[model samples]
Target chain A: MIHPLAVSHDFGVWVGALLTLMVFSFLYRDNPFYKFAEHVFVGVSAAYWMVIGFWTTLWPRVIVPLIPEASRIVSSDTPLPERDLSAVVPAVLGLMMLSRLVPRLSGLARWPTAFVLGTTAGYAVVRYVRSDFMHQIQATIGDGVLIPAAGGGWNVAESLAALVTLSGTIFGLIYFMNTRRGGTVTTPAARIGLLVLMVTFGASFGSAVMARISLLVGRLQELLGDWLGLL
Target chain B: MKRPTPQILLTGVALILVVAAFMAPPGDGSSGGFAGAVTYADRHFSSWFGILAVFAFLLGGASLLRTHGRRVRERKADWHYSAVTLVSFLAVLIVGFLKLGGPPGLTGDPTDASSWLTTIFDSVLSPLHATLYSLLAFYVASASYRAFRARSLETSVLLGAALIVLLGRIPVGVTLFRFDSLSLWLLKVPNTAGQRALMIGVALGVVALAVRMVLGLERGRGGDGS
Candidate 1:
């Protein structure tokens, strides 16, 4: 059967199909076409991200706030007429980061780097404490182990599940204990922890595989449905 | 001493920012007082960071150009591929900047969907990224096959869990033995419990590291203990 792509002259689809094939060629062997495609991919991706960074982030956030009039020029959704002096501080700090590209002035970059590090560290502490620590502990503690049955008594399966989960969590924590000497409590808990960790890793691996397969399916759909029109 | 001064100042700024975050008024957008000033400062600093992060992309681009340029200049093996890399980089950059095939105006957005930039991105970069990511499917299949060998008790448990998860997620397993329910139980209960433990530990570690950085006990940027 003649493919629809043979008749229709969609240049964009053709280009996409060819590039997708070029990338897939790596599965057979590392050829020049694959290398060419790989490098182009890297270059274009870097450029694309930079374009997004400038247009979406840097231009509006740093420039427009300081210059305010740039809002009109850049087609900013919200036009602030008054200049914000506060915006100038980050611009200066950002310029300080760029100074590292210069020879003698490289020391200036540390200020921005330090600022970034500090802010990130500060930000992470708040987020991690609230979400990862407090929320997780709260969930663990508040996990309804004993579900009320239809008649009146607690559900045995749910209670067992709760016990297992509590045991798994405790054992997982015990596994990370560095100073624990081999003992009745520590050894058994450590063993259970290892088993729990192994199960977790396996589940993670399975999920990762599923995700990759979905991507593969997507590419196949593009090739067959879009390019070949076989689907 | 010179290096330490900047480091110290940056640390101080971080601490102040953190403290300000806590002290800032809950939802006062009017810019009334100290809360307003703190909010203003916070935003400016954040924007500066965003701008600098964008500039880092330039450094990355420069590095790419330098690598390929050197290869082209030296006439190294497969130097033609280097040429391809450099040419594509320049082509995309110039095309995007000029807004070639964009709307007929100087004010046209360079990255407008209708522009050549988006066309190249859609046809080339998107496919390339998708294909590259999809290649992991082949690698993962092969790797999982190799890794799932039940060499010992620990390995057996791992293999069992992996197989259960893999099969249970698919339609056939769901229809055959209600493995989906079993998988869900494993994932929601034991898996979540294990993950929570790990996350709590990681959070504590992060808090410690952040405190160290704020105290200026940890080295800032170069990590040379400055």
Candidate 2:
């Protein structure tokens, strides 16, 4: 027996494949096909967000609490105490987000924005001290460097690589430091730091490229196996 | 001389709501008021949004037609490109929406293998996207060559360390130099340490940014422009 969801899923899979291809058509040249796909994606995403925002965020959180529920206790006229006012606080703030839609009331949105920013900054500061500064310092020191080789198998290259990594990390950190003694742009230590940054960026970019290609390969495999049935 | 009542009211509402949200009981798992509401929201929002977005597709198609149709009619330079784009766009839209080439026996089975839309997307679009993404490889190599230069003592040290890491990652680098063990150590110990540090810093930055946004002090929503 055919599952009901299967029909929809299959339709979705084909539609998705076509959309992906349309987006890719940009490589050959920008064309209307790509634009249509892109616009459809955008429109769909926006509409979806609105529905989600109303059903998920607005109705249950705001509406349900406002409705009085039957109390379990006998001789009690009161409904289950309304959900704590605090629970609705974020929703209120979120609602403030809508103020941006109204030109005259848009400035009201700033309060929520500020609240979000302040909390984020506070969190980052707390997190950074432990992770970026202290941990990095402690990590630079390794067991191989400190302990003596008891088994007569002291790995030289391993120790050296560790040392280089440690040095490179330090230099890279220094390169990013904003403080400078003078107007000079090039400093001995700073140059080494920049080099380390460059290598890291290169490796990161290469890895990202490889990851995308791998994903593409996986998609292709699916197309061949399932859609074309060529496997 | 004029007061902004709407602004003040909105701000007041936001402040009250934020405080209320934090104070609400960490509701019982899947049962309590606050927690249940959050869970419900998370589960249902995305699908709801997806449904709404489907309708938005019509708006997008209309916009595309308006913009591109005018360009083609004006005989603009590169008009042929726009013509191709429009044709492909309409073709896919019609096939996919109308379920053309769908299974012969089925009523609404657009996913059938014979579907022209599926064939076009699978054969043409997927590879193009992949190919575009793959271009990053060349850009990365070019950027590295241009950016990675040793000009100072610290830079030289950094370069030396990076070379060790580079050599350690690849099979050729490890086999040629016989530095497999060394590379392993470099990645596990030093790389982890560096990554942790960066993550911590990033976390801190994120927190600060979030706080600023919440407080209404920071402007621009972390974007480049006003």
Predicted candidate 2 versus true structure: per-residue lDDT over A1-231, tens digit per residue: 632332224554566556666766665787887766655543333333333343344444544454334222111444466664443555555555556555798665554544443333433444455566556566676453533356676667557656766777666566556326663435667656655555554344434645755666666665555444555
Model 2 chain A poorest 10 in a row by lDDT: A67-76
What residue runs in model 1 are displaced by over 4 Å at the alpha carbon? A1-8, A69-72, A75-80, A149-152, A178-186, B27-38, B41-44, B102-106, B109-112, B220-226
**lDDT per residue (tens digit) for residues B1-226 in model 2:** 1333433333333333344344434543356566565444334333333322332333345556667678899999766666766776666655654556756422434445676645655555544445445444445556656665767554454455556666666678788997667655645654553554355446556656544544444444531112
**How far off is residue B181 in model 2, in Å?**
7.4
In model 1 chain B, the worst 10-residue window by lDDT is: B217-226
Model 2 CAPRI quality:
incorrect
RMSD of 1: 3.3
What is the lDDT, from 0 to 100, of the residue A158 in candidate 1?
81
- Enumerate the candidates' DockQ scores in order: 0.61, 0.09
